[model samples]
Target: MSIEHMEQMETLLPEWLETSRLRTGQGEVASYIPELAKAARDTLGVFVADSQGKTIAAGDYGIPFTMQSISKVFTLILALMDHGEEAVFYNVGKEPTGDDFNSMIKLELVEPGIPFNPLINAGAITVSSLIAGDSPEDKSQRILQFFRKLAGNDGLDYNMDVYHSELETGDLNRSLAYFLKQNGVLKDPVEDVLSVYFKHCSIEVNCADLSRMALVLAFDGVDPCNGEKLIPRRYVQIAKTFMVTCGMYNASGEFAIDVGIPAKSGVSGGILALVPGQYGIGVVGPSLNSKGNSTAGVHLLERLSKEFSWSLF
Candidate 1:
């Protein structure tokens, strides 16, 4: 992981951001979540945290936004930490569903009702149930602990408004939860599991916080700042494997081809990416492409990976 370091990529990031923002107009913001759609569509930003803990950024990198689906990565890792790998994988899978990120049809089509991968909403909810907890509050605390550990910030908190908003409008997630319950894949009650899942989805952070979290994964679960292991190595493997395979919903394959890095994206246009064993990258652009990935975020990553040769493959 040793490398020459840039004091800050922020000074040069704006030029890179501007060049990559051309695709924002070609895509639409997510309207399903309602609140997510109201974000400034034209906004695009990039933030990077290297192995040295140096921060760099440009554009709307400071914009506050809910983690949305991006939080699933943390929850999946948390569930793995609570339950062993075998227990986690038994309920969810590592392969991509290739359907929309929010597609319920995949749940119906997959036999025995196992989710195609933990990055999807259905899979994430299933993972949420595996946390060692008897109540929703108990389960959520485990997640918060994991997030705080990785983000290196105890101030990270759930946005109750966003959580309630998703709860009020989450018919699809509710239906998926019930489906998992009926199939015997859910460990907790559907409502309880969904509560934890939605709350994780509603965790709020700006791009800088996200890069710190992403950097943990980039460093293989070790927080470079203190050289401490924040996540188990085995569970880190599972989380990143899923990110490479299913992180961007249906656009994962295309992302792999273009960006050549393991990455995750949310409906809020936040993407967490990495060059494993190297540097972690984060991007935000409220507008999303057809597959619910950040439009400019995609372009920015593609160009960054190309310019820096950051592919894991």
Candidate 2:
């Protein structure tokens, strides 16, 4: 971002955050996971970072939250890096399901039976099974290390409370894994795959951590700060394309029209977004809309995209 743009954001983000926070009442904290319900319903936060490492933060930006479904983006990239495109795509399709991220109805009804995309719960579980590892523990460790590297924060770790909560309450995810196994889609045992999947979802991060991670994607897998390549550009292209199409659950189309950027939102009310070649953004609003996205976070991003013309479309 330019100096003038940074100054403008510093001046406007606070006011915009307050304005967006009012939308919290229109949504509710995610309760199915149980632990996520503990987040303050009215809290909202954001952090914006540029390639030069300059940053602006607002609201409850220091608060921590789990990555939730947002972890799927990286897991998918890891799977691609591990097995290449043909092997990865053999396990999952490229189109959006248009169904809820967790729904398994299409697995039975849809022909061929693989998940339509990896951002959804079913596909992520499948991707988790594809990670190259000798055991579930090894796979989870690799995922955590990859995420820490991308975020430039070795301290990044799981919220054990959230991990246990999701593991205990993830009956639906287990069912999906079992179905995939039955369909010959998953080679690993069901619990083994869920072990990796839930651990990655429970990985904890704050807005700043999320912004740094998004910054890597913004620069097409290169960490611009130190000029190091973290992921292949082709894999980054595939990941960003998935982010634009299926990152927001079933509300992705609406988000694309309104925010016009590649973004992935998690049930913990975290949104990871990037203005390609320009800025990376992180937002958190524990209050969630019906579509399982952060209510105020989406609103804030829409406003920022319009104010700054950051949309890719």
- The model with the greatest TM-score is 2
RMSD of 1: 1.7
* Cα lDDT listed for each candidate: 0.83, 0.95
Candidates' TM-scores?
0.95, 0.99
Per-residue lDDT tens digits for candidate 2, residues 1-313, read: 5688779999999999999999999999999999999999999999998888789999999999999999999999999999999999999999998999999998998878999999999999999999999999999999999999999999999999999999999999999999999999999889999999999999999999999999999999999999999999999999999999999999999999998999999999999999999888899999999999999999999999999888888
> On a 0 to 100 scale, what is the lDDT of residue 43 in model 1?
93
Candidate 2 colliding pairs:
none
TM-score of candidate 2 on Cα atoms, chains taken together: 0.99
Model 1: residue 286 alpha-carbon error in angstroms: 0.5
